[model samples]
Structure formats: structure tokens, C-alpha cells
Target: MCSGDAATVPGGHADRPARPQPHGSLLNPLHLLYLACFLSQSVFLSAQFALLLYALQLPLSPTMAGLLISLGGLGPALIAVNIGKFIDRRGARSPMLVALAAQLAGAALPALSQSLPVLFLSSFISGTAFIVFRIASQQTVGRLGDGSTRAKHFGHLGLVYSVATVAVPLAAGYAIDHAGFAATFLGNALLALLPLVAIASSIIAIPGPAASAASGGRGNSAFALLRDPALRRLMVATVIINGAWDVFMFLAPVYGSQLQWPASRIGTLTGSFAAGAMFVRAIVSLLTARFTSWQILVMALALAGACFALMPAFVTLPLLLAIAFLGGMGMGVALPVTMALIFETAPVDRAGEVIGLRTLINNVSQASIPLLAGAVGALIGLAPVFWGLATAMLGMSWSSRAYWRSHRRKGQSPGGTP
Candidate 1:
């Protein structure tokens, strides 16, 4: 068994020096690579969304534009787990290199040919690349450190993406407003080079499996992880909370449009949410030290649900922004904790597969939830959408309580529970 003070041994060995802990400096090559990868992802997403807006300006139908934009998500949902399997068998380096190449091609394609077919093709390729990059990066990060160090790195990773989520869009919008869409796409394509160079230079440093043993026999698959009752509860909670986040993103703009809120105000409201997330992520290490993952997940979900439920009741921008901030805090706190829990609980050899499965679940939810919410909004009105999400979160809080009780019965400490 792995101890807090001892390093985890490979091949089920109880006695061995643990891998070197990650350095604290942001200048470390691995940390730089992490930053670059996240920045690239942010740029890619911003550019892709900008592409849709540009498509609309090109007189493409809104439906066609949406289809083009959604193609990015489609590829990942289909192949994320397979890519994870490849990472498990081979290593992160090759898949990361491949993903970068695809990202380059995807960004360049649309810049070179502004046609509908090229746009569609680029979206699919880029989307697939994005997922591949994410899985590889996440697996690599997981391998970089142990215990608290692992948790810290994952927290930083989440923060980078959170910041990127806010910054990239604003930057992309500015680029489109000034330099135009093609320039923005070309810039993103060029930005992809930074991570490529970083990964290439540091390829030798990327961690590999300590041993060649797989998690279990061939019958033990990614889906099998879901069979663990505790893990299942965590996964369900993650799915519901994340699904609510997607709904909020979708409904926020739609709701703003209905209320005739200015674009600037709507943007600020959304940005507030990101700000809240960043704030919580900034302090997640300290928070994790104090609270159990179960407690964090339950509290964040319940609070975020209350925030969502309150959203429809307000018309003033300040109240809305406050709600957004609170909601963001809830999600922000839950994300890293859930991620840490997954890493803590997953079998060592199957880390890549399990993370990929998590990605697959998240991708599926993101893709499907918004569509379903939109449909429900059309039938009953948008207020119910937020209400429904709120109710789901409130319900998940009880599940969390059950999990907490079960853990206590097993004599597990808050920090000790996987």
C-alpha cells in the first residue's frame, strides 16, 4: 500500500523510492508544456467558435455553421477512449506529437480554404486532435507527481484551462475584429508550434510506465471502472454537475438575448463565472487539504444548484453576476477534487484508460446536454431548465451523503477515501 510519506512502487512492490516530485517552478519544461498545451487548446476553441461567427458572416446558414462548430466535439466522443488505450500501451509522447500535427492541419485547413467542406473537415480533425492532446496531457500530469503533489499539479492544470476559457475568447474576438478570421486562424496554427517545440525538447522527460503490466486481464476494461460503487457515485455526481455547467453556458447567452442585455454586459456576466472558478482553483490545494472530496463535491453541487435556481429570479445585472460568481465557485471547487479522486482511485496501469473514460463521459454530456436543454426550453420555457439542473444537483447531494456514510463505515478518513 502507498503511504503518504512513501512513493508509490511499480508492479505492486511495497518498497521503492518514489518518483521525484515535480519542481515548484513554473519554468520547468513539463510545466511549460502544460501551460502551452492548455493555451493552445484555448486558442483552438476560440478560433473554432470565431470560425462559426465568420461562417455566418459569409452567409452560411446558422444551422450549417453550428454543424461545422460541433464537428470538433464529435470526433472526441467517438475515439477518446481508444486514444487513451493507445497511451496506456505505448506512451504519451507519440500521441501528443500526432495531436499537435493534427491541430496544425486543422487550423491551417480553414485558413487555406474558407469553404464549407473544408471548414467541416477542419473541425473534425481539430476536434479529434484536441481530445487526443487532452488525454495525453492529463495522463502525463497524473504521472508527474504523487499524492499532494499530484493534487497540486492537477489543480494548476484546471486553473490554466479556467483562465484560458476566459482569455482566449476575448483575444480571438479582438483578432477577428482587427486582423480578420483567416489571420486569427493562422495565428492559432502558429501558436500550436510552441507546445510542439516544448514537447519535442522535453520528450525524454515525459514519464513512462514503471512497469508493463496492465491493470487486469483483457476483460477488465474502461467501462469496468464504473462498476465500483464508490467510483460510480463520483462519476454520476461529476456528470450531473458538469452537465449543469453546460446548460448554464448555453442558457446564459439565450437568456441574455431574451432580456435584451447588451453583449458587453452578457460577456461580463459570463466572465464573472470564470473569475469565480479561477479564484477557487487558485486555492484548491489548501481546500483539498482541509476537506474530503465527497464533502467538496456535495457542497459545491448544492451551492451551485441554488445559484442556478436563483438565476431565473433576477433581472438586475449585479444580482446575476453574484449568482454567476457563486455558481462558478461551486464548479471550480468540485472540478479538481473530482479529478484528484479519480487519480487517487484508478488502478495505476489503467490511469490513461480511466481518464479517457472520464473524458468520454464529459464529452458526451457536453454534446448532448445542451441539445436536450434547448429542447426542454422550447417546450416548457428556459426557467425550468435551470430549475431542473438545480434539482438534479440537490439530488446528487444526497447521493454524496450516502457515499460519505459508506466511507465512514469503512473507517476511511476524508483524505483517505479514494
Candidate 2:
């Protein structure tokens, strides 16, 4: 899995000069790579959403549509750890290229065939490729700099991603409504090619592990990483915050449906949330400069909880949009901060693996939370789902406070603190 050209200095090479790290410039190729990663991911997600709707139109049963949609995560969840190990052993470049190719093929499959089997296969391939692409991009950003510089880069990364998250789905939905599903899928496949080209053109400049660091040194196992108190707390916080997002997306539509809101109004509610997220992410670096990641994360969770708790009571469109926007800001602000903390605290050699582990947790949450929300909604009502998530967010905020206090009491500097 290793690369021949990869910088790998043997042990006792103290005299060997360190390889030059990128200057964390906004215009660097690494940033370009980040943009490509964001676009690829956005396209994949939008297409997946579109695909589900398309599948429903194919006269498939609701259960069958759900199955087709969930199939995308199945392959990635199984092999994420191995994918991380491969990136750690070799480098992100090879895998990034491979993921792009897989994305192209995955998008092509659904466009070319309307059969259920082909769609299932497309989801599997696309899901696996998405994880690989994410791991590579995250690893590169983690390695691009340290401290504030790293935080700034990650802020920019999250901002682009948030923007794409809001815009791409709307665009895809428009295309689907106007041009039809086949054309939309075909366009997505073509869009995947732009990133593939970008990556191929900038292959020489993609940031990766240094020679000495990539020299086959042993590192902590994934379980061992989990055992670290700080990382464990980070993981829990990540799961909770990310899980809330899943719950919100699923529940918002259900809530709207129950209230007899039009589909366009429901879309606006969700879009408002994304708009809030995009707003905070745009200014994340400034916020990080003044507050530690832990502080920001805790406060964001608390605010998000309050917003969620209030969400069930709002029935008017403007009022609902306002609550969703505030809640979006709460949820949006935590994402990059959490990610920055994970990278800041991770073992250098194991960053890829740790990120893979995080992705694994996120994928599991995305798959399971909706089903959990649905069951809970059926048993009690949709309001309880929002209330339950509000409770979880408040709980995680408390735990985050405890985690930071514990670290400080032990005289440990978690870094990125103001």
C-alpha cells in the first residue's frame, strides 16, 4: 500500500533536514484540494438525495426506497478502518485519485441504468468512495499546519463545505424537477470529473506526511486512540453534535408534514438552518481566535439545545424559520471547532486512522439516528425527537465542560485555547 516516492527517512536520521511544510496559504494547492473534496462530497450527497426521490418515482415501495438509500453507507462502514490504515501506510494522493474515479463510475451507473440492482451497486461504490475522499482531504488539512494556522484552514474548509451543503441540494432538486432524474444524474457524473481533473493537475502539491513521520513507525491502534480521555471525549462530542444534525434533518420534514406545510416551505425551513450554519462557518476562524474549541463547542451545543427545545412550539412559517436558523447557527458553529480539536489532539502518524474512525462513527450515526427518530416519533410524536435531541445536546455540553476541567486540573494544555 506504500508509495515509492513517499518521503520515508529511516531511524537515527536526525541529521536529515525536515521536509518543508506548506505555508497554510489560502491560495495553496492544498486549499484547492479541499475545495475539490467539498464539491465532490456535495455532489455525492445531493445526487444521493435525488436518487432516493427518483427511486420513489420508479414506483418502488417506501421500504425499498429506504433500503436503496441506506445501501450507500454499508460498504464504507465495513472498510473505513482499513482505508485509513492504507492512507497511513502509503499517502492520500493515490487514494484521492481512486476515490474520484470511483465517484465517476458510481454516478454513471445510476444514470445509465434504472434497475434496482444497478442503483444499489451505485450507492455502495459512491458511499465507499465518499469515505475515502473524506479521509484523504481531512488528513491533508490536518497536516497542512499546526495551531491557529491549522484552525484557519479547517475553518475555510468547513465554510466551503457548509456552503456546498446548502446550495448543491437546491440546485440538484431544481435540475431533477426541470430536466428529469436521468439528466441530473448525468450532470452529477460530469461534475465529479472537475475535481478529478483538479486533483490530477495538482498531484505534485498535495500535502502529505513527512519522510521521517511516514517511515513505517508504529502508532496507537484505533482502540488505543479511543482510550485516550481527551480523544474519547472529542469522539463523544462529535457523535452527539453530528447526531443532532441527522435528527434535525429527518424530523424537520416529518414535523412539516404533520403541520400540513407545503413541500417548498419545508425546504425553506431546512435551508434556513443551513444558511445559519454557513454564516457561522464563514466567521469560524475569528471565533476560534477568541475562544478555545472546547468553549465554542460547549456554548454552541447549549444554544442548539435551547433552539431545539423551542422548535416544537413554533407553528408559524416565519417563526419556524427563525428557530431553525438559530439552531443552525448553534449546530454549524461546533462542526469545524470539533474537527479542529480532533486534528489538533490526534497522534501525528495516526491522524488518518483517527479521522477514519470519526467518519465511521458519523456514518453509523447517520444510518441509525433516523430509524431511532422514526421509531420514537411513531411511539410518542415528532416533538419528542426534538426534545430528546435537545436533552442529549445539553448532556454533551455538560460532559464537554467536565472533560475540559479534567484536562486543566491535570496540567495538560489541550492546545488551540485562547
Candidate 3:
């Protein structure tokens, strides 16, 4: 049996799946992998938009609409860790295909019927499948290279998702407006097919699970991975970052609606966030070349916190978009860097599980943070909610001070992957 070491990175070199050498063109392994990721993410987000529009068109109650929509996140929160473990044992391919297929089926469901139960089931299926595809994609990418290259890969990956974030919603909105809800949902399903075709084409070889993954014992527990101090800190940081993001996404539209802003203006505000994120991800490799991942992450948190603190003061569309853009840049840096660090920190054999844990944390934050923020916003105000999260973000940044300090003092060089 191949030992777990088969997947480990040592001395800045990684063990990757065997694949053909690129022919010095754009259509290489990494690009193909990115294509698959882009297709999957597009389908997920577009389907989500279609679902919300369909629910509202159904004249569902606001409470019912929220509940139905949130089931997608709930599905991932409940099963992400388990999915990770399965990936660790059997490999990403089987799980990825299954998840993508489920995504396809889920997207197609709304096309068949506008029934409440069908929408609920579709929401959960699409959410769960999207998370699985994402986790699998991350795990696959993590194994593609060593530390520095992995950082670059993740930056590119982040860019792909950001592009999808900005573009997909607009497309989905247009599609829903013209094609109608069922047709839009069906289109999402059709879009999901590209990823499956990409995978089947074998342009990128996703690594199989290490043999040792199947021989897991005490050390393999997903929670046990947190025993590594670095990992624990990273997890805490991820929770804060993801929670802040979820809250902003939730709070922004509500605030805009309350102010009677048009959908186009609200879209601009959110689109600016994605634009900022996209801009930063495009240049993150240069940033990483001069700074360690931890440094970038800490700065990102502080910057985002500052943005949040400044948010409540701004009411104009241009100003709000600017603040949102800056906040997005801050968060944009933190996210991919966090993913790179987690993969670098975890045991190679348990990479998927570690990714799965992060996914679980993110999904949980996505599901619950908005609800809590909504409740708190209703009780107090959006301003306090923004300020409260700002404080939390700043606190999280301060908590990480000791980590980067100690690591730097121990002779970790600038630009070294954490």
C-alpha cells in the first residue's frame, strides 16, 4: 500500500497525481481544474438566485422564504465533515461526480414543479452538492503543488470564484427576468454539465486518496487535527472572517432595501465587493512574495474591521460601494491565504478532512450568522450589528498577534509559506 507520505509535501516539493506534461499552452492542468471550479460555482450561485426569485414569485411568506433558502447552507453544515472523511478514504473523484450530479438534479427539480417540498429538497441538494464539489476541488488543488505554488494556485482559484460571484448573479437576474424561473433553474442545471465533462476529459488528474487514509486511528479524528496550535488559530480566524462576510452579505441588501435603493444599486454595492475581491486575488501572488501568509491574514482582518467600523457612517451609493470594495479586498486576502495555510498545516493524509472542517465551519457561519444578524438588526439596528462585528473582527486580529510574532522570531523568513 502507498503510505500517506505519498501525498505529503516535504522541503517544498509535493507528491501529486501523475499527469501528462503541459504543452506550453493555456489549456493546462491547472487551468482545466479552474474551469471545473468556475463552472460548478456558477451553477451553485445562479441556482441560489433562481431559487430565491422563484420562492418570492410563489408569494411565500418572508419567513418561509428565508427558511427555504437557508436549507442549502444547512445541508452542507450537517454533512461537510463526513464528506471530507469519505474523500480522505476513497478519493475526490467519486464524491465530486456524485455531488455534481446531485447539483444537476437539484437544479432541474424546480423546472419540474413549483411545489414547496420540491423547492426545499432542491435547495438542500444544491447546497450540499456545491459544498462537496468545492471541498473536493480544494483538496485536489492542495495536492497539486508545494507551499508557494499552492498559494498561487489558491489565489487563482479565489479569482475564479470572485469572477463567478460578480458575474453569475447578474446573469441569473437577467435569466430570471426574461426566461422565467423554471427555465433559469433549468439553465443552471445545464451549466453544471460542463464541469462533469471537464473531469471526464482527464485534462487534470485529481489525486486519489492515500492508502493510509483508510487506516485511520486516533489521530485521524477531524477535531483531533486542531491539536496543532497553528491550525487551531487558523480555524478561529476562518470563523471570524467567514462570519463577517456572511453578515455583510446579509446586512447590505437589507440596509439598501430599507433605504429604498433600487436592485441595480444594491447589486452595484455587492458587485463592488466582488470586484475588490477579484482585484486583490489577481495580485495576491505578488503580495505573498514579499510577506508571509500570516502577515497578510492579520492585516486583512484589521483592514476589514476598519471597513466595517466605517460602513455605518456612509449612506451614499458610491461611498458604500467603495467601503464594500475595500472590505472585500481585505477578506479576499484572508480567505485563500487561510486555505493555503490550512493545507500546509494539516497532515497530508488528512488534508480533505481538514478542508472539510473548514467547509463545515464556513457553512455553519453562513447559515446562522445571517439569522442572528437579522434578529439583532431587527431588535437594535443595522449600524450596531455592523459595529459589533467590527469589534469582533478587530479582536480576532489582535488574538493572532502572538502567533505571527512567535513564528517570525523562530527564523521563518519573509514570503515563506506558513
The TM-score-based order of candidates, best leading, equals 1, 3, 2
Q: Estimate each model's TM-score.
A: 0.89, 0.86, 0.87
lDDT of 3 at 39: 89
- Candidate 2 TM-score, true structure as reference: 0.86
- In candidate 3, the residue pairs with backbone N, CA or C atoms under 3 Å apart (3 or more residues apart, or in different chains) clash, namely none
lDDT of 1 by residue, 70-142 (tens): 7888656677777877787777887888888888888888778898888888888888888888888888776
Clashes of 1: 0
What's the count of clashing pairs in each model shown? 0, 1, 0
lDDT of each: 0.76, 0.77, 0.80
- Which of 1 and 2 is the better model by TM-score? 1
lDDT of the structure predicted as candidate 2? 0.77
| lDDT (tens digit, per residue) of candidate 3 on 1-418 | 1112344342121234323333477877678888889989998899888888788888999999988877887667668888887887788888888888999999999999989999999999998899899989998887766565666678889999988987899999998888888889888999878778667666556767765565662355688877777788888888888888888887889989988999999878887887888899999879988876777888888999999999989889988988999999999888888888787777656778889899887777777788899999999999999999899888878777666787668755222254
**What is candidate 2's lDDT per residue for 1-418, written digit by digit as tens?**
1111233234211111123445567766666767787778876887688779878888889998878877787557767777877787787888988998899889888788879888888888887888898888877776665544555667778887877776887898899899988888888888778888877887435655545447774655686777666678788878888889988988898899999989999999998998888888888878877876778888999989999999999899999999999899888888777777776666556667778888888888877888888999999998888998899898988888877777678766543343
Output the lDDT of residue 338, model 2. 78
